[model samples]
Target chain A: MSIDAIHPDWVAVDWGTTHVRVWLMSHDGRVLDHRRSDQGMGRLDQDQFEPVLTDLLAGVPPSQSLPVLICGMAGSRQGWTEAPYVATPCSPPGIGQATRARCKTWDVRILPGVKQASPADVMRGEETQIAGVLLEEPTFSGVLCLPGTHNKWVRIVKGRIVSFQTFMTGELFALLEGQSVLRHSVATRGWDADAFDIGVSQGLDQPHALAGALFSLRAESLLNDLSGTAARARLSGLLIGAELAATRPLWRDHKVAVLGGNDVAQSYEAALAAQGAVLHALDIDTPTLSGLRAAYAHLKETT
Target chain B: MSIDAIHPDWVAVDWGTTHVRVWLMSHDGRVLDHRRSDQGMGRLDQDQFEPVLTDLLAGVPPSQSLPVLICGMAGSRQGWTEAPYVATPCSPPGIGQATRARCKTWDVRILPGVKQASPADVMRGEETQIAGVLLEEPTFSGVLCLPGTHNKWVRIVKGRIVSFQTFMTGELFALLEGQSVLRHSVATRGWDADAFDIGVSQGLDQPHALAGALFSLRAESLLNDLSGTAARARLSGLLIGAELAATRPLWRDHKVAVLGGNDVAQSYEAALAAQGAVLHALDIDTPTLSGLRAAYAHLKETT
Candidate 1:
């Protein structure tokens, strides 16, 4: 079949739980304009999603009638219709099924997330972002980490996602510092590098001793009168230790690319660097848009 | 000063978050009477603590009241007043300040929890339980595993709590199966021994490979058509694997006494047995009560 070159009105939509972003693109897929909203799929009920999308794209010209591709939690079971998960060890722009948005005039298709059997992990929109990364850097082979509430570490083998793992590091931190008894003992200060480094070292040195290490935060405060900042460091060490232990196998010989915000990615980079692993960082936002666009392009080619 | 031996009525209280238990006893520390109420210190405002205690012990003759000993979360800063933490490498039933509970008519003292400095770990009621175990079996030396929301594996030497560690295994299992994406893929069937054994073996073997193994559950289902039960098993394996990695250091050489409910304790026993460690099971509920009573007896003799 001869590929039909279609001029897409909007480049892509990276609609996640906490944020929604849309890109306006030219015929060749250059981003001409962009818009973002905090009305993430996570915050809205299923029925309210269509109107919100319409409201966000109200200014776009109707005559352009561009194909809009969506990805992220917008395709989750709780979001729009559940987009089937594509099996792993598959190429970027892995085959994704299209679901029509509940709007008549807007033709929208959500990209499917990817699932892997070995290591038993799954990713939603991040898979598409990974696809974008693969699209941009086809020769790169190693580990790609997307840090968030449920941090994902994906293995890329020659542009294919072979396997992946998810760590609830961010969520666990939030739960411990915000909800558990440890909250009262810890200070609400920002990150501390000395503490972070101490944590990372301890994490790597005594990964199996995490539970005991966690209690040490309280002990340090009571015995040596360790400051709350130090307590925070101890907590960080416990969490990072668990993460390191969980991710060590996947990262044994591979170089690593971190895809997330600067702060989160930086901590992971430091941890990996300490372990003598080569590291790279990609802007999470751009790759997400690129991935969405890639999926849109794939859809346009097929239908 | 010579130790005073008083034949006063002894009161033992186990004050936790959701419930408060009190035992009125003879001078020999035999339970003459017992009482329980929903007025745990966790539920009451700081100011209401004295009044609630007064209400709970309204009928007890003030003259017969001896020193009241308390344990558990009541000593947390948010509970009553922060009972100071006792540092490690100390004697059995480590030295801690006896803080007065918020009641005037009764002379109340709360037990301080044990703390470690190097790894920053602490535990409150477990120390007292260790004390009770020591009091009961003075020559007993082994790893005492207390499994719960935050499982504790404590080391005992003679009658004192020498060192200890904690695990968030239970909490992690709950979060993964109940809250995370794995929830959709797992089955709620009872324990699967083969799956459990697989998890234990994998956990002990590759403590560091846990995160990657977790993603494989979903991948295996997609690529190999695994059953929901098998998916659940894989998830269990990932968690158990991480836990084993975190806890391997403590269980490496020490003889282990699994202290918890039947199922939880049994699971740990089986896991440890697979690793060729000597394991014993102890009823968690009885030891806690026995420990409280022992504390009461000590208070009666020393006051």
Candidate 2:
């Protein structure tokens, strides 16, 4: 169908563990409106998804019903429905589809997340964002890093997400400082950038010993009486160092682009800068919208 | 106090969380008797420590009363009393002492653990084990790896601990496979050494990318349908590989010795072998005893 042939509205949903966001767009694919709910897929059981989705879409006109494309953790085994995984080095063009969930007047389809070999990692909604990046910058190439709770490093070639990797740096940091024994020894303030830099240098210099370095944070507190912030920075360096060791090979020769929340992205930028790599930072939210829009566009073209 | 003049019967206590081990040693530190109780320091309130110790030693003859040396988590802040940390590059002669605990005729002293700067990590009981190694093989010098929940990579010169580092490799592996999102994507058994080697190589080659590589385990499983054991092996490789990258620098010119539980020690051996490092595996239990004995001997001679 041609773009002008249908009066359908386009709805894009990025449903994750803690938040649900829906974007409304016109037939021409321009965003007409947007709404977000705190009822993230992470907090709800499988059965409650449809009702929550319906409630979120309550005020829309029936005739303006659009094909909704959903992504993120909402399509995992524990999600509303399990979306099949798309193999690595593959792009949104090859992303599998969720069996469409039929609302009374609209057809709703969730976008499948991408998976890859090589380093071996998975992504849910981020793949869509990558797809959007590809759509917006068709000729862009090399490594795209999406940093967050589970940071991802995607390799794109000629607009395809040929391969990617993920790191649990954010999660590990949270657990160690907030949940582990080191919590007692650490303070809430006083982050040392120099200490962080030291960690980065050590991490890049000696990735295998990164775990051992973590214990040093506690030791510094007990032995040298380092401030809590320095300990926190040390912890960040340890994580970043391990990350650098793991990802250095993948992006060795490639130009890098970091995509994610601001603080995380900045940290990644700093890490890349330390290695003397060329890098670019893109807004996570914008790329996500563009990715969702691209998915809708692809679906429209295919059907 | 000469060994010949000391009384014949005394207590050797390995007090830790979850379990208490008591060895009734002869004046010369021979195990004349041994017993264990579940009343570990971890389960008791701080004020209850003395009473527990007293209750456990209730029936021992007073004439055989000897000095008691305690080790492990019992000396942590949450345990009987906080044993202070000793700074790194510490020799047998430089070991710190815990504030003494006295009961009637029995004298108690907790062994202090070792600490290091740079990465800022610490360890308590392991240094004693290093001391034990020094006692058993006084001429040996190189890297000693004590692997456990928190693995220590220690440097020894002559008979002193010059430096050390700790890794939470075991803990991370357990958390990822048992508690994280990747848990369901991996298998419970069937280890693949080759896959692990691949992970190690990747980590070494791209030390900076370690974090991004971790996410690949789930992605590989989702896209390629990797066997659970293979997935698990990949996970191990990623972690071990990262560890190798971090630690390799320290052991570049040094001989390597591993002290740990058999299986874990074996893994460390395999990783080090893959890196073409000379390695020695030491029994963790025996070394700990040797370390305790060494400490006791040192104390006896000095006092």
Candidate 3:
């Protein structure tokens, strides 16, 4: 169809702290148009969300009250509408639990996040992604290793989130590479697979020595002229491997679905594969879109 | 003696990254006068160090070619004089190995630091402290735990530094407490010894689970309304405990001399005590001053 020929049935949004993405979906799940903005929930106050969303959608030709489905931090307490979290051992909240955000022209539904009570943990946008994963294989039971700023290893059995854990590995890598003293030694851009592998081994085998290991990067830089690229790669590997060491129970003997196709995910996949994890890679987009679709279907059925 | 009645026989200066301290020493090792400024090596360029020192010593009546003994990062490659480091398994660099800076009036001698070639570790200012510790007990042999921005664990055997390791524990704690997401949950002030003890135990016992443990602090704050003070204490304990876990060989089954009277050193002392470490707390100023005295004595003998 020509760009101007078709109208969107519903809008799927992946809203987060720093950015927001919108996909204009047709009735059959085709993406008619895609849009994005830096005006994420983190940047907007409560009242500013609707206006920002409305402005971003201004290019869309008028259609009869489009249904807008939003997931992620936008449903947080600081978001447009607070969609309370659903405790774990429960399915990712579907349309029935979706909260409504008041809008002048569209019926907006926001998916709730998931929360664990003891040893407390929470997930927002990823819950939608989880629902999307469930959409494709409702009967699938395995662990999902979602790699991001705060990497989450979620255990799933027969479609409900049994439990999950988060590791600050990605954030640590960012801080160490960009802010810590190691910044001088670690390059901003480069790849060193061998160095990465060594780092992973060190981190996994001698996890206790992380604090000392970090200082060694700077020491090596000063004493042995360690290349910045190698230091950077090693930093990444160290953090990821440390995370894997901590989260070993989640994926050690289980078949795992590695989410996303990003560099971080690939690194996680490699590290996991090195550990003899039976793994499969999934497109990062598949679960989010499908999750939104699943929510949309639920919204239609319940209403 | 009155301030104006006594003239310094020599000057001892400990210059570090963020601050510089100067002490006018009498012929018999008495501190005639003392001064400090934030104009540390990290803040000044090669040329600025002399000017800053000159300005600070304006109050001291200039005598004929006064000898100045300097230590710390001021001898770094970026400092006033590039005093090369002495490799380990040797005594802390004394005045015999001091480097001279081309200052106008003062005979400025900057003592060299110590370096470990194999593990790639180095210490600048703390070496002066080590020299001072050795000055008091010349034949003492044990481990010295120097806590600061970068905590160092040094093994001294019969007046020589056998080997040492640096842990980014203090730096990591600062970053996590002040800059990381956990900052939102941790308080800037408050104390909870019990919480700290628990964190230390957890960190030591499950050293590999540190990444997950850190995230749990934030989660606990959000879900359980965990107190900020407790979280802060726990965070400190966890980082220190992790460092202890890594450097167990340095302190375990060996007598450890815990340097510094500050909170950081005390924290390390307490954590080490919990690990059944044989520790003796020394006044923070003792080693630095003693080390400077020892170097000053050597300078007199040489020059």
Could you tell me every candidate's TM-score relative to the true structure?
0.84, 0.81, 0.93
Best by TM-score: 3
Q: In lDDT terms, how accurate is model 2? A: 0.73
| Docking quality (DockQ) for each candidate | 0.33, 0.44, 0.73
- What TM-score does each prediction get for chain A alone? 0.87, 0.87, 0.94
Inter-residue clash pairs, candidate 3: A132-A291, B132-B291
RMSD, one per candidate, in order: 6.3, 6.3, 3.1
lDDT of 3 by residue, A120-229 (tens): 89888999889988887887688999988778889999989989998888778888888787887899998999999999999999898999899999889888899999
Q: Rate the local accuracy (lDDT) of all candidates.
A: 0.70, 0.73, 0.86
True contacts kept of 2: 0.82
Deviation of model 1 at A52, angstroms: 2.6
Comparing 1 and 3 on lDDT, the stronger one? 3
> lDDT tens string, model 3, B129-171?
9998888788878999999988899998898899999988888
As for DockQ, the candidate ahead, 2 or 3, is: 3
TM-score, predicted candidate 3 vs. hidden true structure: 0.93
Give a tens-digit lDDT track for model 1, residues A111-140. 788776554556788887887887788777
**Residue-wise lDDT of candidate 2 within A1-303, one digit each (tens)?**
222232337778889877999887786768766779999876788878877887777666554246777888888877888787777666564224655654555566777877655555677888888888887688777899887888777788888888766788887787777756578666655667788888788777766666666666766777778788888887888788778766776657898898866776777788788888887655445788888777776676877
The CAPRI class of candidate 3 is: medium
lDDT digits (tens) for residues B185-285 of candidate 1: 67876656787788767766765545445545545555566677877765666565556667666678777787765677677777778777777655446
Candidates arranged by DockQ, highest first: 3, 2, 1
